[model samples]
Target: METNNVLKICPPEDSMKDCKTDIKCPIVNCDKVVFSSGSLRMHLTRSHGISESESDDALKRRIKVDPKVYKEYHCPRNDCLYNINSERHFTNMAGLKQHFLKVHAEKKFKCSKCDYGFGMEKDRKRHESHCGMKFTCTSCQCTYVSVEALRTHCNRTQHQIPEMYTK
Candidate 1:
């Protein structure tokens, strides 16, 4: 059986810090935190007169060469937006991957309980909240309002349905 492995990246409980706001400007004597790598690259270009072409290697080297400055993961999407000294960026590669997975990558949000899918996470969550309309037992011909209820009834009564029907 092919099972769906849904990746839930966002909304980590107890950690509300936005990744876009955590990256610090790596340039010396600069205590600035910006939105994204594109924004930081833009900042380097506009404020420091650094060339965009050389910034990636140069910026990484600067961080290693200088301990005072912090690290940043540049967005892989070069065409990502930058506007008015603010844009998308991440502090870690995981954050970058998460951003890409949520924004740049094409995906379908699926319900863990069923084959239902949605283009947006919000829609899937809303559907899953009350998705339990009804489930029927093949053995006893009993109807249940939810899969959990049906499973409970099956376990208590030992009225086992086929594996295909259970799923």
Candidate 2:
């Protein structure tokens, strides 16, 4: 008969003599040592092909639902209203750092036609629909989706109107 073996992300506190970091691989006989909990999670996923949810569950079980261990980092922005009742909390330092960089850092993507800027490409694309270069039909009260579409419509219909192309 086969017996189920439970996996844990870290050993109990009583077992820690020299392991100050406390983040150790749960795999049997694996001596891999990492500095942070995040690194250990990454090691589990990359090296052992364990999914994030699996590692997270194991970590939670090992840590015994300790809020101090999980919610160590909190967002410092006072004006930012993310989870305002409880405040935005992160599981690790890296997650908090990344949240700060993404939410408060300078915008990376900018629209050339307008002064609008965004942090992500998808936001820029959404803005482009309204602010980016568009083709309008001068002949009638109609607008084409793109320049190529306008050109095709104009070529096919041969509608002669003043100022055929406009930005």
**Number of the top lDDT candidate:** 1
TM-score of 1: 0.26
Can you write out model 1's per-residue Cα lDDT over 69-143, one digit (the tens) per residue? Answer: 444444444465511122344555455545554565544778888857754465577778868576788897889
Candidate 2 Cα outliers beyond 4 Å, as residue runs: 1-73, 78-102, 129-167
Q: lDDT per prediction? A: 0.59, 0.56
- What's model 2's lDDT at 51? 59
- The candidate that wins on TM-score is 2
For model 1, the superposed segments whose C-alpha errors exceed 4 Å read 1-67, 82-88, 112-127, 130-167
Worst lDDT 10-window in candidate 2: 1-10
Candidate 2: C-alpha lDDT: 0.56
